[model samples]
Target: MSWIMPRRSLGHAISQLLLQFRIVSAVARRELQLRAAKGLFGVAGVFLEPLALICTFLALRILIRGAGEGTYLNLVLWLALGFIPFFMFADVAIKAIGGVQKGGDLYFYRRLRPLDSLMGTSLLTVQIFGTMMLAFVLGVSFWEWEFVVENPGRLVFLYLGIGLIGFGVGLTTLIIGHLLPIVAWVIKSFLRRILLWTSCIFFPIRQIPDEFRPFILWNPIAHGVELLRQSCNPAYPAPGVSAVYFWGWVVGSIGFGLFIYANSEELLFANEPLPGLDDGDADL
Candidate 1:
């Protein structure tokens, strides 16, 4: 019976792997279908918003030609790389949290998990926007300026860093989304504004006031932008940023998300009756 036992174990392992693959695939498919139904309008924000910002920067460049040491092209690139990711991550976080609440109808579907929905949506946004940003960067390089990514390693590291930051931000938003619905929405909006201002999207962190420099350095978006700049711009004088710090933020945010998920039912559902069901036996 030893051979039979081994065969059963193999079957069990295969079943588990298949289950996981199915879950991920299902989630991904639903996400794609939902976004697809929105047609161009849903996904257009990913490209159009960044392009509009780039055009505005280009115009500003013409207006400020002799004034600043930094070129408008670099600023546009920096903002695109930095700001686009922030918006993508933030949207993922907010939507993930809201998806859990809104997905009550689908809760009965055993194959789906709240995390899966969140992740699927997040992945969809990243895949759409990340591709657009890369294409824009390459197109700008070919058309507007002469630029090349000389160090492939550094470029990869930078991309990883930005991704981690996005994941962390998204996870944090999920936690907040669970805790306070309306407040979470407001906070999400405020955080996006703060990310834009502190991200060094249009200007260098070094250009900030001395008193604010220390606090600004602590901003994760600033670190991400700096890291991206280091990768894309050889003209950048400083050494590349420390990857450990960026990774730390990612890990810490994920850990916090897991912690929140573990206790989410308690934090999210305290004093709130289930939807459409009242504490009393009678229907509302």
Candidate 2:
């Protein structure tokens, strides 16, 4: 006598979603193929750029204070630790905003979706940069330098939190930028530049003068970098950093981004231009 339809199980839904891993992998493979075309070392472009920047800074540090056995190792590790996370966040966020437009042509294929494009770019970013971090760590290990981890689990969570912040910002910005091309340009020029300067990439948060600590702590990335340094070296002092606030930014960014994205996903596929594109080009 029951007229109700059978209920779909959450477990089944999760399993089905997990199956999409294949799609993610396929898209990621295509990106890798394209990058590989640049030649043998071409695939390393993203990682190399960041590593080069860090080394430039390290060279300056070495020149100022003559290199000792442990001095270069310590400085390099500290810079690497901060650089990896910040660049990961920056790279993913920036690509996420433009992922749709750049790969819009791909979504024409039945298996691809808007989120798939973002996921592919993110995967590429992580793979290249993550491998770069591993190589740097191994080089240090080869020299037998001591870089003990105080909280391995916390370090991982914090790293992921930074990545989440990037994904969230990218997602939210992609949606807004999809509708308003100018919004994307403004953010690309301003917010990212501010974050790069203030994220404590070259120095520790504790090293900052007290006058600037308040403003610096407001940047969750500053906290992320400082906390990462302390995790690598307990001697690194970071008083103003707060895990709660850092995680808050991570959660808020992802939540807001998903919310906006979900509401406006249709615009992602509208071959017709979004609103702000005066020239009939809504994609930024």
Q: Which candidate achieves the best lDDT against the true structure? A: 2
RMSD of each: 4.5, 4.8
Please give, for residues 1-284, the per-residue lDDT of candidate 2 as tens digits: 34332334666677778768878877888888787676556756645766787677667766875444243226666667777888888888998988887897797796778888788788877777777766766676566665455666777778878888888988988889877989988877655688888998766676679998898888889999888777766666788888889999998998999898888988887766456667664356
Model 2 error, position 69 (Å): 14
- What lDDT does the true structure give each of the candidates? 0.63, 0.77
List model 1 lDDT by residue over 1-284, tens digit each.
67999999999999988887677667766766665566576656545665576557656654775336345335456556656665655666556656666655555785666666666666666666677667767876886667645554776556655655565555566667665567667767766677667766656766777787776777666776677666776566433345577678767877787776766644543456667765656655
Q: How many clashing pairs in candidate 1?
A: 0
Q: Model 2 TM-score? A: 0.84
Residue-level error in angstroms, candidate 2, position 54: 3.8
Off by over 4 Å in 1: 1-22, 40-75, 144-147, 238-241, 265-284
lDDT of 1: 0.63
Which candidate has the top score in TM-score? 2
Alpha-carbon error at 197 in model 2, in Å? 1.2
